[model samples]
Target: MLTLAHALLPRIHHLAVPLLSGCSNDLSSRRAATGPSNFSIFNRRPTAENRSRLQALLSEERYLALDSYQTFGSNKKNKEQEATKHTKDIKLQDGSGTNSCQEQNSCLENQLETYEWQLKILHAVLTASGEQEREQLLKDHSGDICTLIHSISDKVKTEVRTDLNELHEKHLKSISEQYQSEAEELRRIHREETAALNEVFASSEKTLKEEIEGLTSELKLFKELKRRVEESTLKRDLQRNIETHGSPGEFWEQEQESLLFVIEMKRQHLQEQRSKLLQMQSMQNEDFKVRMENYQSLIQQLSREQNELQEALEQQALQKQKLSQEKEELLFKLLQQRTDSCSSFQLPPVLHTHLSPS
Candidate 1:
């Protein structure tokens, strides 16, 4: 019922504004015809002597003729102000001092009928109480549907205030408790990890110094081999680019596999380097002899340049993973936003449920 009323309001305003404009023109015509009420409507009454005065008055009121939207808004505001004055008070046409039992029953019956209609409207809105979180929404706010008609009639200011305050307080307390629990868990983990990383970093640095000396020599050899590999890869990429120059889309589609292959090779190279680092990290935990020959056997034939290229590739892999994650997260956030908008559009069927009277 409320939705129907709301839908009607704008169309009504559209219709009413033009009607009023017509009436105003009629009134102005009447004013012009005052001296001769029976005069034809098309007849002009402005005299030559009063022409300047008439022009000035018309110019000042020109805004009324040109600005229909402004006029409609002003009229709507006046209506709201009038309705506000009627709040908490109903006017009876007859100003009788007293009413008999039959008259009183008839008045009560009329009020019941009106209330029933209001109840039906409320039911429609309540069906949307899945809480789309829209303010100034048309939904029935069915949270208070448990209240009886008698209770509704006798609702006091204190009752409303208390309900609102209680809901707010309860909501606040839950939010605070949730925050505190998360903070406490984070603090506990920080304390535990700080001590562990300190001890490990101290031991790891000593081992890393010993391994670096051994690995440097091995990396020098690998560096030469890696340079040749990158040069070969670049040449292949250039050849492919030249071969498929006509269509960019088709070229990219063909290149996808090659790009993925290159990325995979780079990933494998990083994994190999990471495995070497992991060994050093783990060697610190072992009880084996401090023989430097084990480091020699463990070290690959990679040269210094290969190690540097491998490090750069590892960084690129990390960045690529981060980018992929961010893209997924952005799409997920967009999907969530779309879901929220769709939620707001609770159809008439769902709203009809909560809107129904208890």
Candidate 2:
């Protein structure tokens, strides 16, 4: 950056030195460049009439940079107001709970971008002006012209780099702090949610285990009853066999089938609960992904807006340059016409003197 300043300073001095040392010659060169008529006007300006006209032209000449600066100032003010309003709106939204802090952060980021752009525009406008216009502006605005010039030189030497560094530092710090807070909040929420989920899962598992234990105890009781009944039946059957030679086994087979059906139902209930838990986890992950996508889209939108603004500034500069050139041409034509009219009036005088007999 210092190297850039050093490089520009020589060019600035070159431009300024010519204007300071030989303004008339510079004006003559400019007139000569415009057209033959302007060059004639410049030559004719030594006469009293032409001198007065030249003085009038000099007095009435409006520097293009003056208007450009006024326009820049008005636009800058309006933009600043708009940025302030935007910030206020963000604050209001935040206070009302209508938008999150992230939105406020984004708004601030946009404001910073706008400020940076405005600064660049200001720098361009200042540096783009002709040396004469700059000199006039400085003379009009400052009491100590030399001091002001030196100050400007010093500022040009370091200000651009300093300002850029400050802006970057500010932006980086804000972004870092914002992300840090967000990350901390996310970590806290994650911990809370994880703990809650763990508690819920533990409770569910405990309930399932209690239920399984109860079912196991019930199955054990049924088995014990079946064993006792089988023992009694065996004794009775044996007695019956002893009394009336017979056998019984169909009842025992029916009891075993009923116990198998109860076990299958318990297994099906456990599988259904596991599937529900898996579905809930999947839904949570999808929600997180959607949120991430939204954030990325918002960042892209901000970048696009910044790009558009930069392009607009560049177009405006181009248009301003074209307008300035057109204005200069018009001024030259007007001066040429005035000089022609003055010369025409002098023609009749010379004709009268020639026509008179001496």
Candidate 3:
């Protein structure tokens, strides 16, 4: 559009200058002539052929200007579409370009009107019977024509600047909207990811909780079975001792005390293990796998200790059985010696009763 304005500027200057010069010359010639009023060298009317030629030129110029305006309008439309599609890369268009186009369009129309008026005034001046009418017509239109031409360039520049500023603002607004949309999309995606992570954590937590419960139940069952086995073994040992001694002896009492101590120790160990399990259960912040591993290790340690305790108890029972056998042999020897020494003497009933083996 700017190029178009620049091109039209020179054309307007060339066309206006020659026509204005010829008008001035004709008016001067009319002023100088003293012949009857109208008949003079410069006052001659233009021929029909000249009038036809001028009309054809004016029509062609008007047609060219209209064609250019239409072409510019189409191009502006295409460029606007492209701008909308690729907002980030869009060039700043002059905001007042449309107004400039309209104004220039009006200016061109005014120029054509002035030209037509000038042509009419020229014809009338040549054909006028007197000088007064010619002078009045020139006086009425000359200033207006000059003023329009002089202001055209300034108006075009101002409107172009205005148009550019407007385009720039529009471009900035588009970019802002684009940024806002992207931000919203990012926020939405973040929310979705957060939700997904929460879901996964929840699922894992639930699974871990279930697994812990299952392990706890298994541990309780194992401890119960272990307790029953130990109790049965102790009962069997006690029964064997009872059958051998025919009564509970000091050895049996000592064995029972040792067994009670071991049971107390085992109970204390179980209580400690239970406390550890409770502590582990309370530590929800720790990782599930780590806590699980700790629980497994603790259970294994308890099992190892239980096996050692069982082995110790078996060794103690074996030693007690050997001592009981020696004690029985000594009692039999003492009984035989007493009976020999008192063969003609009567023994005390309490002593004899005590010396008799059960």
Number of the top TM-score candidate: 3
156 Cα displacement, candidate 2 (Å): 5.7
Q: Candidate 2: where is the Cα deviation over 4 Å?
A: 1-152, 155-160, 240-358
lDDT by residue for model 2 (88-150), tens:
787787676443534654564454344333323322223333556544443343333333235
TM-score of each: 0.18, 0.29, 0.37
lDDT by residue (tens digit), candidate 1, 129-162: 3334222234343332223222332332245457
Higher lDDT: candidate 1 or 2?
2
In candidate 3, what are the lDDT values of residues 242-272, reduced to their tens digit? Answer: 8888786865787789879988987898799
Best by lDDT: 3
What C-alpha lDDT do the candidate models reach, one value each? 0.46, 0.48, 0.56
Superposed by TM-score, candidate 3 places the C-alpha of residue 330 at a distance from the truth, in angstroms, of 99
Residue pairs with backbone overlap in model 3 = 94-163, 94-164, 95-163, 95-164, 96-163
Task: Give me the displacement of residue 235 in model 1, in angstroms.
Answer: 3.6
